[model samples]
Target chain A: MITLETIRTAHDRIRAHIHRTPILTNQTINELSGVHIFFKPENFQKIGAFKARGGLNAILQLSEQERYHGRTMGPVTTHSSGNHAQAVAFAARQVGIKAYIVMPRTAPQVKKDAVKGYGAEIIECEPTLEAREAGVREVIERTGAVLVHPFDDDRVIAGQATAAKELIEDADYDSFFDAILAPVGGGGLLSGTALSTHYLSPRTKVFAGEPEGAADAVLSFKSGKVEKAPYINSLADGLLTSLSERTLGYIREHVTDILTVSDAEISAAMRLVWERMKIVIEPSSAVPLAALFKNKAQFTGQKVGIILTGGNTDLGKLPF
Target chain B: MITLETIRTAHDRIRAHIHRTPILTNQTINELSGVHIFFKPENFQKIGAFKARGGLNAILQLSEQERYHGRTMGPVTTHSSGNHAQAVAFAARQVGIKAYIVMPRTAPQVKKDAVKGYGAEIIECEPTLEAREAGVREVIERTGAVLVHPFDDDRVIAGQATAAKELIEDADYDSFFDAILAPVGGGGLLSGTALSTHYLSPRTKVFAGEPEGAADAVLSFKSGKVEKAPYINSLADGLLTSLSERTLGYIREHVTDILTVSDAEISAAMRLVWERMKIVIEPSSAVPLAALFKNKAQFTGQKVGIILTGGNTDLGKLPF
Candidate 1:
């Protein structure tokens, strides 16, 4: 498990680079659910997602010798659906390194354009996890480039923890929140947030929100062991990752519960956010809110802090 | 003319009640136009439009006696397409007053539902200014309700100026900016921004961006007289207004340039913003960018500020 001290250090390092994203207070939501809901809107970050925090922090933490001597080679390589690819590409550009992104051919054009705009090279692959993984491995082997796994690295986890650190520091809602809910995919973000909350604000319980179709984390939490889904089939593409070993350990210790919601629920939550908050957020970011609404009985009369993890949704293709 | 001091006072009165919306740095636009472009994203404001600033400030300024007395006489009335109507409805509901909104029958159902969600009574009229004005007057007189003009009012103009105030306060780009560009409708917002730039940073020039199809503001500015269009037939519904007397006076003195963009250019700008920034914005908010892009020569190598006044666009029905 990642230590709280490491998470704290990561928070301090990334504080200047990442946006202390705002928490939106919804009166209408409170009135309807009888739950005090505060949305940690990470959608407003520099790269339009929280992935920037982890990607940038990890890249920045490389030793001076490692960086200058090309110990990590000339490029950064990653396999991502969208947001993570953009984050890696953006961070690589910032640090004067080339980025080679392996994306499924079916990925949205907008995401592709964004990655390209950040001066990254794109390698298109078949729309399959195996294909993406194989493609990324080939690139890493051929170019001798550093592989920035989207959410599985310890440094990445620590960097993602900074979001929770800022949220806790900016808002005096320590005693107000009964639990903190975050979307769980490969689990770097969830692990980092859980780690930060366990030490910084131990009173608040941590809950992992997973889509029903991609509920590997839920099964893992239930079985008291790590689990993996061979392939994910859900609208929340960002949450398709099977649990990593480090994230599994973090969840076993810090996460109190794992909740699941259907794709329909995720879509509905996305619409609610757009219509009510006027902020554009991707379907993956809406999973936590879906979990909150699905399990309202558990959260009623309690303050629930939900991390809206990303906003990479293409407005043109809204399910509505 | 409403002095900049009065606008600053309005800003203070409503600062806590409204959101300090973010300024979007347009990197893609800057590269495309050879201009440093910064967009004031007022679409993220409370009530999902810039109108909230004015509505909240106007309501906050009312005396305690007015709060109680106003409620007894029934709802406040306003004639608007959606944005201002929703703003007034939200403000009225927040202050415990009933609201009656007169909207065109052709108004989007989503907007009507938003107003209704705020507990406002909606009165529909033919999709014409004459019909809307007549219908709203009847409702106002019958209910003894106060009328909140969408624009063309001192309070609204003062409230609108806060966007410019915030832009200057948050970004110290005075050295880079040659001009601030804003869309003009009834001229309330443009006039307010002009006054703000004129007094706060006299070195920066102010430009009004108007729709080519609805070029009343541009004609008025060029003629050095208040001009009214026989009818508004532009896609930018928010900029379809005849300039008010006070607004005209301020624009005549403080505004340096008035430029127009075709509706096609506005549509392209909206698409670019959605595709690039991943933020949904309405047609009026895209006008300033359209003007800058259409007349690239005017803005090349110059720092420009464009107020993206609202983001109330329905992603489902994008013009593209």
Candidate 2:
């Protein structure tokens, strides 16, 4: 469970290691959504995503006994085909540790190259959830490396909370934003965001945007239990994972609601941000804005904050 | 004709109306090019380009007699199919005036839409330069709108000079950059940049990048007169214009050298900025960076500044 002190402590631990990414605003974006929107762009973060925060926090906290084998790090490991892979790899190199990233053979080349570029040893596995976990387990058994779960960890959740903490601190003068939104994938960002909002600014409500193709979080929110999505097909490729019990518990308590948007809506919003804001954001980063525009009545004339998650997108495969 | 005082006065005249856009740096870019690079990102400026500075400066300086035919502004006219058209249109809107933009019929739709979105009346003509000039002259004859030449006039050059002025002021403290680069089209930005560097950071050498496909500026730089390119073709659509007599005069006096790059090199460098820096930049903006990388030995171990011109790219037609 994350308390206010937990996030503050995590921020202090990782503040020097990661970027306190800037909050950007645009008049055209505000007029279109009918809200005074403040965008917390994590796309410009280390490794080009907010994952850098949680990854560094998790790694930096390793015990002297647990982290070191003489001079070199005992090695940390993670199985991811996403920004988290690059995050772990980059964080390890920053603190003089070795990282072993287990990615599926079918995973994107851009992500793979980025992880390797950060000097992480990549172990390619079969493109299946079981294969990925097995690969991580194999690496742990052989190399005596610690497994750093991508989302379902107390340390990572606490670390992710710092993004919202920074956002609230920067955007507030007298009162906080009227509402705040973040995309829900494995629910790590949403849960962390919710906890930070509930602790730092009680009046502000927390909401999440999930892709219609990956509707597990929305179902879990309604059913009061972790649930699998009915289907999986979306341009927002980063939000395709199921939520954990740890993440769902926090979401059910602090989050107001979960909204889903179609791929058409997501791509449209993404293009607008690129064309109007002149910032490169991936499809997943557009989900919250898409939800806001789809249901604009709820936030008309109010100050709303949306976390733009990352910018690690493959430009070769853009959906106009 | 454009002195340091002229640029300073222009900056004062249009500071409130324009965004003093940010200067961004990326570690990967610096390492690859082996030079400490400071990027003046005018891509995030109003109208999504640096053209906004000159356009606003020109429009804001319109006289009480020349600018007023009754109540509404007498209207401003320009013949451009690129970012300049949108700049004039956006600047006109800011000052509560009408803008008549004469654009070639073959101009990209994305640019035409942006100009129209800013309340400019678009007058389309044949794709030839003569036809475009006739269209602008016709607009002047009918509505009496003052002609704001894209880059030929001294006022426009002085306005464009502010981008480099701000770049030098922000990036230098004890010593100036070793060299600075800007893409040369009609030479407005390059000539203005040379003048500002000459006045403020006299130690900094002024260089320019031009596409070999549209390689008129290099010839003009050597010939001491405006000369046309052998052929007109490039992915950097914004840098296809030939230099004017006024721009050529300034270039001969202050500019150090002009470098030409192939379209392939420009597109590759453009992708690198988009991928590594996570910022949206058009093909023309990447020319200077491309030239820097192509001739890296000259800039090794030195601090260099490059002005990233704009970000008005069409997502549907991105190369690559």
Using DockQ as the measure, which candidate wins? Answer: 2
lDDT at residue B169 of model 1 (Cα atoms): 73
Q: Enumerate the chain B TM-scores of all models.
A: 0.93, 0.96
Q: List where candidate 1 sits over 4 angstroms from the true fold.
A: A12-17, A62-74, A173-176, A226-231, B12-16, B22-33, B56-75, B94-98, B171-177, B225-231, B275-278
- Residues B107-207, candidate 1: write the lDDT tens digits: 98889998998899999999988999999889978997878887778888888888888887777755346889999998888988988887787888998
Give the per-residue lDDT of model 2 (tens digit) for B59-90: 88774445465555578999998989998998
Highest TM-score: give the candidate number.
Answer: 2
> Looking at model 2 chain B, which ten-residue stretch has the lowest summed lDDT?
B63-72
Q: Write the per-residue lDDT of candidate 2 for residues A1-320, one digit (tens) a residue.
A: 68899899889989987878888999999988889999999999989888998898888877444545554458999999998999899888887889999999999888888899999999999999999999999999999998888899988989888999999999756356989999999988898999999998888989999999999999999999999999999999889999999999999999999999999999999999998998889999999999999999999999988999999899999988
Q: Model 2: clashing residue pairs?
A: none
| Lowest lDDT block of 10, candidate 1 chain A | A59-68
A1-320 per-residue lDDT for model 1 (tens digits): 46778887776777776777877777767787788888888877878889998998777766344867877536779999778899998888877888899999998887898999899999999999899999999998999778888777998998888887777766675655688889999899999888888878889899988998888998887776778764578989788878877788888889998888899999998888876676678899999998989889998898788899887775556777
Pick out the ten consecutive residues of candidate 1 chain B with the lowest summed lDDT: B63-72
For candidate 1, give the lDDT of residue A268: 90
Model 2 C-alpha RMSD vs. true structure (Å) is: 1.8
